[model samples]
Target: MIYDLLVIGGGINGAGIARDAAGRGAKVLLVEKDDLAQHTSSSSTKLVHGGLRYLEHYEFRLVRESLIERERLLAIAPHIIWPLRFVLPHDKGLRPKWLLRLGLFLYDHIGGRKLLPPTRTVDLRQPPHGAFLEDRLTRGFEYSDCWVEDARLVALNCMDARERGADIRSQTECAALIRKADSWTATLRSSAGTQQIEARAVVNAAGPWVDAVLGQSTPDKPHENLRLVKGSHLIFNRLYDGDHAYIFQNGDGRIVFAIPYERDYTLVGTTDQSFSGDPSGIAISDEESLYLCDAVNEYLKHDVSPGDAVWSYAGVRPLYDDKSSSNSTVTRDYVFELDKEGGAPILSIFGGKITTYRKLAEHALHKLGGFADRSWTADEALPGGDIGASQFAGFLAEAKQRYGWFPADGVHRLARAYGTRIDRILGDATCLDDLGACMGGDLYAAELEYLVLEEFVIKPEDALWRRSKLGLHLDRHAHARVADWFAARKEYA
Candidate 1:
């Protein structure tokens, strides 16, 4: 097939690039070695916020752009992106309250924030929010940011790309790429065997393996230099009781976040360590776990440990290398390198974040100028995010009233995950029983069937872990039942 752009790596950058290009009337093909978002994209800190710490590095442009994009995402994907308030307890001896307050003031005025509330001060000794905090802490600063289902964001972007006439090939690897005079030929390896695609342009958006893709995707340049910094997050059962996430300033100059996650758990993480090995091999080290535990214990009254962790995941950040002395000091801002070899251009994306992906995609395609079509993805709503600028609660009530009988849990899950596409999935089914068995909590046989038939989900983990976090709530029996049922469906197909 002839495509205008071939995007390698189905992580957030690749997916977002594909979605934006496809939306703008480009023929696009997205190839992922594994399932979409099965890597670093899924393992994000899951916040759509301006990096408050980046201010220390004087990254004013990055912070300003991120702040703008954060609000844009909340507007476009309200179902999955919701506002989160973070509480940063003021440390008396570390940095003066005035400095912290000044930072917050700059953050508030960084971009013209519209939907989210402004920053405020909190007394740690007071009732409600402070009751759980340690007695030593007295003052706190609260600010606004948004939380995103990071994995789902990638999936939704790919789905939206597919909806807009893009071919999304998951579990497919680009084994080779050869430049034809005015176009490019990508040799793709999949279970079906090798196939060649002709594209006018190719995007190397592979997160940590960007250098690998440069070597593997084409032979023009042996490699493009990028840095892979390993970061890890640990999930523990509820650390305290409030909805607000705790942001702490460690003595080492690194910040840690104890964010409320998945109802019964608190997610804490992100250590910036220089890594030399493959990103796939990077996991939470024994020392890193101890470091995290100590960081959490520093602020909380109740200390935490690895034994308290329910689960943990690690990711490698593909940062643009400016030869920073420390990994933590490396810029989080993205860089684009355009190679106009073989008439067709190769756009290589260096560094970016979940918060800045939409803008990054827009900027990437704009850099590709003559090759990529023109359209604004900023104003566009992603797949399952087409409530057309309506209040989420209003949209929810309306969706429930419209599809009221399709098992309350199933209905909510479908609408929240797929937005308007839920109606198509329901089809002629009028009642709960008509939708099929309840595979688990909130997951129904109907949703699984819909996924296999439409969403390119093949493995149980694809549906359970990435498509939905039903695995966390599902018992062994429920997981097995879903697996067996999925296997039976595949057998018939």
Candidate 2:
């Protein structure tokens, strides 16, 4: 059996492409070498903005497409993606206020924003947003973007693809790809073993490893087409007490974002340094850490050191090598190179942001020259995202009322993680005792079972880190217990 489409890489772009193709009635198969979003997708700054900083680089088209997609994503996955107001403190040393205002104006008007509010000036000397900042910063600009559960977005797309008759395989690598006149025979390698599958076309969405994957084809093509840029972020104990985030401008013509993360921490980061190494096991450099702390210290009343960070993650962006002098100037737009040289179509994806992933998928499929004409993802909701008219908070309130016996934090966590699908995990359970073993924190046996059984969470880290941020709340003992639980399950073995 030949699949209509075979997608490589399990990040947002690949997953989204598979989902889109499957929805368009194509026989799709997506294979990921590691767990979904184990790299770049998971280690993002996690904003669904139109790349407000990209405006300075004159990336108007990318920003406009991203801004439009931002609103569409918010409408489709309201549970995972939500409006986040960002306070950009006016810094005389960096970009001028007039330039910032003009950029914000373009951003507000370009996207056709409806649900999110427009940009406005903020008084930093007042309360809440003002209290934590330095006295030198008198005023700022408040604008809206969005926060997204990056990994979950990938997972949910895979889930939707699966539901639409696409085979979504994780922990599986494409060891070899043989391109025939009309089809592709791909050798897939995993712990289980190697198997060959036929597909009519292939998508090289391997992200940082895209060129490497393309080299694996039967008649290899010389594809040195990516500028690997490392972006590192640090997680600290919550610096402020509000839901709003801060976008601080650095004196070095860069920007830093301090966002309210995970209800307990402040997520700050993203240094654009050129990276040349294995994309896996990438860590925040000492220099990068100091750079971030210094960037934030310029605005904050209280200084933050590298010691303040409890956790840090870094990812290499496989940006399209536009030959820009600085890594920061590289484009965030998606570029699709469709090669059908005496063989099946091979679409290689390069350089895309999360905000424009869905649109990227649409564009990729359109280039492939098959599938349905009508675009469906824009109006559709991701799994568990259809909360009807009441939306996320209202739906959470109703869930709490239904399960009054559950703890408030537990309910909130479950609602936020699973959204409307919490009903499947909770079932008819009226109390905590019915939730099976407590796997520490708010993680129960029921949720773990659902993750393993439904969400392709084979390894412990998949559930602990990617599927949910349970690792942050779970202690060492809990981690061990979860590992043991997965080991005990024969399916995982």
Cα displacement (angstroms), candidate 1, residue 41, comes to 0.6
Say which candidate scores most in TM-score: 2
> Which residue pairs does candidate 2 place in steric collision?
none
Report lDDT (CA) for all predictions. Answer: 0.85, 0.90
Provide C-alpha RMSD values for all models, in order: 1.9, 1.3
User: Model 2 RMSD to the real structure?
Assistant: 1.3
What is candidate 1's lDDT per residue for 73-118, written digit by digit as tens? Answer: 9878988888889999987678678888988898999888888899
lDDT of 2 by residue, 1-493 (tens): 7899999999999999999999989999999999999999999999898999898888999888999999899888888888999999997767889999999999999989888889999888899966798888898899999999999999999999999999999999999988899999999999999999999999999999998877887344568778899999999999988999999888777889999999999999889999997999999999999999999998898999999899999999999998888888788888888899988989999999999999999999889987889699998999888874237889999999998888888889888777788898998998889998888977888899999877889889999999999898789999998988888785554
**Candidate 2 lDDT score relative to the true structure:** 0.90
Which residue segments of model 2 deviate by more than 4 Å? 218-220, 388-390, 491-493
Model 2 clash number:
0
TM-score of each: 0.95, 0.98
Name model 1 segments beyond 4 Å from true. Answer: 217-224, 371-373, 388-390, 401-414, 425-430
